[model samples]
Target: MVILSGLMFIGISIGLIAVKYKEAYIGLIENRTDNLQTPSVLME
Candidate 1:
């Protein structure tokens, strides 16, 4: 039971990290584009 809980916690953390990483990646792409001048409010 303890090991299962620990694995669940780790999985949740990794999911969060993946989401943040994807958002950051999209932000970088937007920053590079000349058409997008507004900043992403979600990141801030």
Candidate 2:
């Protein structure tokens, strides 16, 4: 029984970490897109 509980806890932790990583990855892509769309006045 103890081993089963430990396995469950590990699984939950991994799932949460995976979700957080995916969110951070998406946010980075969005920031890159925003940077590309804005024109630099210094360049003009």
Candidate 3:
């Protein structure tokens, strides 16, 4: 029973980590695109 509970806790932690990583990855991509566009806009 203890082993099963431990496994469940590990699974939940992994899932939370994955979700946070995905959000961070997407935010980085969006920030990059915004930065790229801003330079072009300033040039014009």
Q: Which number leads on lDDT?
A: 3
Candidates in order have lDDT scores of: 0.88, 0.94, 0.94
TM-score for all models, in order of appearance: 0.71, 0.78, 0.77
For all predictions, the C-alpha RMSD in Å is 7.9, 1.9, 2.5
lDDT value, candidate 3, whole model? 0.94
Model 3 residue 12 distance off true place after TM-score fit, in angstroms: 0.3
- Winner by lDDT between candidate 2 and candidate 1: 2
> What would the per-residue lDDT of candidate 3 be over residues 2-36, giving only the tens digit for each residue?
99999999999999999999999999999999988
Candidate 2: misplaced stretches above 4 Å? Answer: 40-44
Model 1 per-residue lDDT at 24:
100
TM-score of predicted structure 1: 0.71
Q: Which stretches of candidate 3 lie above 4 Å from their native place?
A: 40-44
* Models sorted by TM-score, best on top: 2, 3, 1
Per-residue lDDT tens digits for candidate 2, residues 1-44, read 99999999999999999999999999999988977898766767
In candidate 1, list every pair of residues with a backbone clash.
Answer: none
Cα-based lDDT at residue 33, candidate 3:
97
